[model samples]
Target chain A: MGGPRRLLLISNSTLHGGGYLGHCQQHIQKFLGQNVKRVLFIPYALHDRDAYARTARAKFESLGYGLDSIHEFCDPVEAVRKSEAIFIGGGNTFRLLKALYDNSLIHEIRKRVLEDGIPYMGSSAGTNVATISINTTNDMPIVYPPSLKALGLVPFNINPHYLDPDIKRTHMGETREERIRQYHEEPNTPPVLGLREGTMLLVEGDKATLQGVTGARLFLRGKKPTEHEPGTDFSFLLNDSNASNL
Target chain B: MGGPRRLLLISNSTLHGGGYLGHCQQHIQKFLGQNVKRVLFIPYALHDRDAYARTARAKFESLGYGLDSIHEFCDPVEAVRKSEAIFIGGGNTFRLLKALYDNSLIHEIRKRVLEDGIPYMGSSAGTNVATISINTTNDMPIVYPPSLKALGLVPFNINPHYLDPDIKRTHMGETREERIRQYHEEPNTPPVLGLREGTMLLVEGDKATLQGVTGARLFLRGKKPTEHEPGTDFSFLLNDSNASNL
Candidate 1:
């Protein structure tokens, strides 16, 4: 848990206003600091990769930084190695993981973020791949990846855009909390962070805080879900102490 | 598509009015016909196997049929082979398939329904396992099975409790339609039947019909989603004529 890892894992890019990356620009800047000049953008999750990159380029340019899509470069590995910061946009988690595997960049990106201390930021399916596995993602299994294993960027898995159990809805499908509960029941599964819309986790050298306007729900295997408000530090999720008990 | 295959695939076990298997019982009875004496129930989908069987027992008893839980039998294969009808209740799809694999019943159950002309009925996760693959299910991947392949009782996949896209909601998650679209993008994927709640499909020999009050959304790869009314015969879905194009 103790490292010089800088990460801004956002739940969603858009809030209720439908602004593109409108709410998390400040947090992104705060995590990246002033040294990172350009950001490497991975838009492999969605089918509309070009449109996604254009939207992200506009937002990053507005924040006084340059952004380049990995697909634009002939040598994708060198492109990632040369970047100061990395940003991954949201779409289908399976596609994103498959693309990452297809490009053979899983280890390269992991080294850049965890070893070199490069700033890392992602939203939705992007945030999903940063965790131990994409088992907790809300997206469909659009494509079958080589494995469900993901880069070990974080100790716990993240359930992005997590909707709490709706008490009033007549839908027979299992709710988000119940789904995460089932996930926890699996052997050796980590705690799941249910990050709601407009919320994110900002990780610095040794600690991380749940930032933004909304609260998140946490699911530990056997215990009732505990709610954490914005600004709550979740550095414990990076440690394996509680996960062993489960 | 022609065979002596009798099946009733339901979207949900309960309806908005909170009736316990109320909406689909008539369809089930008609599919099973008047000669079935005992039915075998699969309760491996969720943790509440006992409670699920108890509820299903009361419902089936009222319809002049005897229901027994397969878990209670000493030999699960013998139970499935001897049963007059088969019912699978809904819960987690991954767990259900995992359980089926763990019990080594996939081939046994497939033989019972596909070759023996047994009456098969399932709801939600139950219906999901009847498709060629469980790739299009809305449930989370809580656990990984040996394979994503399902019972192959049907020619096409089914998405139970399919929710329509809400125009006014501000949620950023992928709508039901978009998820299915992504599924279709994968190679060799079959057409997906988006079965809305309170609706079901009745299969007799080579003919299959969408029955009940609500209609279903049909998604074929690279085409606009088409809606099918109740009583619409879905015989085409049982053949690979359109699947070869995908």
Candidate 2:
């Protein structure tokens, strides 16, 4: 299942003082490389597909690749099957997942990315769907999906745009760390990777490396959360057995 | 089915510079009155039921009421059937709703509160469950519940501890207002009330009043969100017909 998988799971598209994908432009260019001429964009996370596609197209074109949205195609499955690369942008996680199931593109997209060895990129909501489940997402349940289960491209779950708690503020809502701890309280749950904004996890073949400016925090069940800096190899997370004890 | 419905739905338990239930103590005592002696506590939203129960018991006791957690009882449904009043504190909405279904207390509690007229007090996650659904909650989906359909004690949904977006921050996450808008995009959804901290809605048989230090915002499907003051009459929301147009 892990064979030929290529993914660049980004925490967010826009960082502070930056435009869309401005923070990670160089990384996106390198991941797609010189061979891929065009990319298929999935903009179902948001309500306005036409506008979302236009934004994504403009961004991808500036990165030296042609981009077409799946919503524009008559057959989304066929579009996914023939796509050189797939990029799912950020928005509402539940809406994005519901659309994926509703469009029947889950299996098709998964097959193309995992088996066919296509380059895959995701930010925020997109990064959430690339993991085992959307249970760890920060988005509101604006809509209910058929299931929490996602693409399972990664063995673990992800919390994108993860924010550290401001101890100075007395807001009683559960902190991002506390929410991840709650997820671990459930039975047989996997480790949760909290990818801070401006950070990403790049996976190629069987290797996963943390990339970008900031670091990420990994939470294992019944253990203190550990922080990993940029350039740390997270390939151990790719193995299901390594996540068993976690 | 509105019958003898009585409820006090609070946004959050603790506010800045306040202890647990500190800001809304007077309203709690007034809502329960001199007739009710004991309050049944539901601590299911948290991982440590005993700890949650202890904190709640201390608060209720200080308000001159006896508090016993449902977990201490062998039959939770029977406990709800015989309780004088109910108080559900704040935590994770998903975990709390799952426990309500798991313990088979949904039907029993609804009967006691709506028909029997036992005063019902809910804060945060509790307020979320008292509404039509938990679709507007700020909590993560730590666990999957059987359904999003909650107690439906109120005709509208609630977004508790609702915070206004800070224009100063460049975080890409959806603002609280935007999340509720996305919820309306779904068909047949109810109106959403965004309750700021230190605020609550007090509902009697035929009347509902917004009472607290701050105010609330009401969002209709296609209309602009309107702000309401503390003393605004929200009893219109109790009527199903009023919500239909909203």
Candidate 3:
């Protein structure tokens, strides 16, 4: 069995714009567990190479880091090999997933991170890829591709930008909590994560801790909402708290 | 324009069981508001009258109200002419909408409520009738009828059980928000009300007030989520908001 190591995932961070790279930096610093050395950047989120480079550079500088310290790659396999820690930035998650599947990068990311024990990081769509299925993605599923698999870094589904229940008016639909509650009613479903902005899950060597704020809500089937905080053992995901897959 | 008055609309309050006398309740309440009294109950939601009456009686008792206050009639025109507040109760919205159109009760209800300045309230299927279109409804848009037009009490679309966004998780085709968002993006479309449970919209003299703890989430073009609070002068629909005839 492979062992757990440092990792990060993103669903989306640019709420209105400008926070993408800063969010990435914060995640990188958190996941590297030290100064990040030799990181690989994927240019899949941008249409133009120059634009991607510019955006990447701006993000790196804002983080007090340099673009040259990181390797930019178009090919997934090559990028996966040279990286000590992999960081996926947020854009259109469906587009990102499509590119990863099209380039056959899913296997490389999974093998390197899950099998090779390389540190992994993702934001927004990047965070979305850490799950087994991309169904929980909040992005429009308009860009549906044949492959639905992801890096399988996390077992729970992620819902970024989770809004709370607003009680004051009449609507003709089910609430988000109600929807998840309905999901839980279905037999044998995975636990769903309603991660508000700026929350991260940290897993390293049989110990998984929620790094951000406590009071994050977990919606389980047939039960009231449960609260999870930092250092709460997520080993429930991998069986025993001490059982490392690596 | 007719002045506002009290109205009660219901979808379903008895949980899984649909009310049979729901349509009759609409006619009776409408007639009562208009001073038309006494009618008979028809079990559309239930195959048997005894079951429907039993449930209806229980509902009335729970509310400390009595069915003896008004006559229950399944007949449309006979019920419409005598009522002031038209109330439709909880049952299958599709079935209720179908029955309303099948018997041409749509025109009569509109004529009495809109033209005559009568109050109108509905629940479950009754609530479904207030919207101009039921296309956004979470329930299956099953129809034996060729066209789908609700009573059009409200001007916009209704998406009952409006769920909050979670990352892509389930294979429920598309989430409610995605569906409504796509509907709006379809070029010259109506607005949608994503109403959670325990919420209602109160209409008084040229104004619609959102009621209950969970207010409606408005999905508009080029805007973040906006809350529609109770007692705020508003429309339960998009068409009514702009007063644009579609």
Candidate 4:
């Protein structure tokens, strides 16, 4: 019974933390429990890990943790293997993905979190990795390079930082809708999770609930984007009773 | 002044034979003299237009042109536009450009065809009008929707086949070397030429040369592809004098 539902996802603490910090902290506490033991931070690529460590340290401290509370590591694999709950902070998703692929940590993380029942939390790229494909990650493709294959943890895709169409004027890339459309074209592609900022998909047992701000969108092909408010549970999507390991 | 420069480009027509029968005979003969009127073909994109057309109509005949008969779309646009002869054969340069863009075409075609006083030719989407970009001839972006801009002819874009890539994988999607690379990066794009079948880039000055055979490669970036022969004229690259437009 405690097999496939041991996940502890935390939003990236340093990603423009203002109002979103409180929301993420609350969610983290809710998932990891108040008797939190050990938390590890992984900063694999950036030349300066102190900045990331400091930001994470501050957020964790404000959430009722010690000053020297969280342990940080440049080696994600080692940190992921030893921790009770692993929190991956977001900076550059490409950098994070590269680090994961480079150190061969994805297989380990998948095995431990999904197969062995460890609490795993992610944000931004971290959250995106929860899905089967990186097709929905809201990052420019050529900014790094294209890696068609991703860590297929969940059956659906994830679009972090999902914004409305008007936001297209600001970014010089394909809209979230356009990219998702491309994904759907691939024969038998998965569903997509368009998670706006502050939105999280909480999976416990076999039930997955939508948490945080309202007005988030879930985009799927041959169907209109169904809008949902906060407290709206998407347990139907995670109906493992009939789920196939396809 | 009488025997000035002109161009005649065909999208895809096989000298050896095998594939779709696009506008080859009438267009080729329209531009080339009797001696130079044989078809030019790029076998890469599956050159077979001539054979198909000839066999289909029964009144058709083989042109039997080789690499010498066909030029790589990598020559100076001016030289291509002003040549005593010109003929662009087809195959997928997007397939061809796996070897094409590295040698560079985005810049050369613009100079030769746009800046110089030479006639230009194209067929299918080969009559490129995808100016803001240069690669959507075969691929259609929207469905009876937005008015997509292209390379502005005389400052516009061309969309040959105007609606081909969308329907067939025989032609890849609109992600050609130059188009995909430039689409998400550049702003304030251009107009285009959506040259469908039986269409051509006709500049009837005093003399017209036939280039592009089998089928034409679309120019979505700004201008047409620079014509070249792998070993003789160029080594899949244009000299500095030619590669200045992109």
Q: What are the candidates' interface root-mean-square deviations?
A: 1.4, 1.3, 10.4, 16.0
Candidate 3's C-alpha runs over 4 A off are A1-4, A10-18, A21-27, A33-35, A43-53, A64-74, A240-246, B1-246
TM-score of each: 0.95, 0.97, 0.50, 0.50
lDDT of 3 by residue, B120-237 (tens): 6565555666777555555421223334566776667656555666564422224567666655544445666666555566665455666655567877644465777645556434
Ranked by lDDT from best down, the candidates are 2, 1, 3, 4
**Candidate 4: lDDT of A182?**
52
Q: Which DockQ values do the candidates obtain, in the order shown?
A: 0.66, 0.75, 0.06, 0.04
Cα shift from native, residue B214, model 3 (Å): 18
The whole-model lDDT of each prediction reads: 0.87, 0.92, 0.56, 0.46
Tens-place lDDT per residue, model 1, B81-141, is: 8888899889888889988988898998888888888888999889999888888888887
lDDT tens readout by residue for model 3, A76-165: 578676666676766545567877878777878878887878877676667777876565555533233455556777766666555467
Model 2, residue A40: C-alpha shift (Å): 1.1
- Each candidate's chain A: what TM-score? 0.96, 0.98, 0.79, 0.81
On residues A108-220, what C-alpha lDDT tens digit does candidate 4 reach at each position?
A: 77776777666667777677666665655543222232343456566666677665665423222235575566555444555676776667778775667778764468766
Instruction: Please tell me what DockQ candidate 4 reaches.
Output: 0.04
**1 or 2: which has the higher TM-score?**
2
Error of 4 at A61 (Å): 2.0
Residue pairs with colliding backbones in model 1 are none
Stretches > 4 Å off in candidate 4: A1-4, A8-20, A44-47, A66-76, A142-147, A167-174, A239-246, B1-246
Q: Best by lDDT, which number?
A: 2
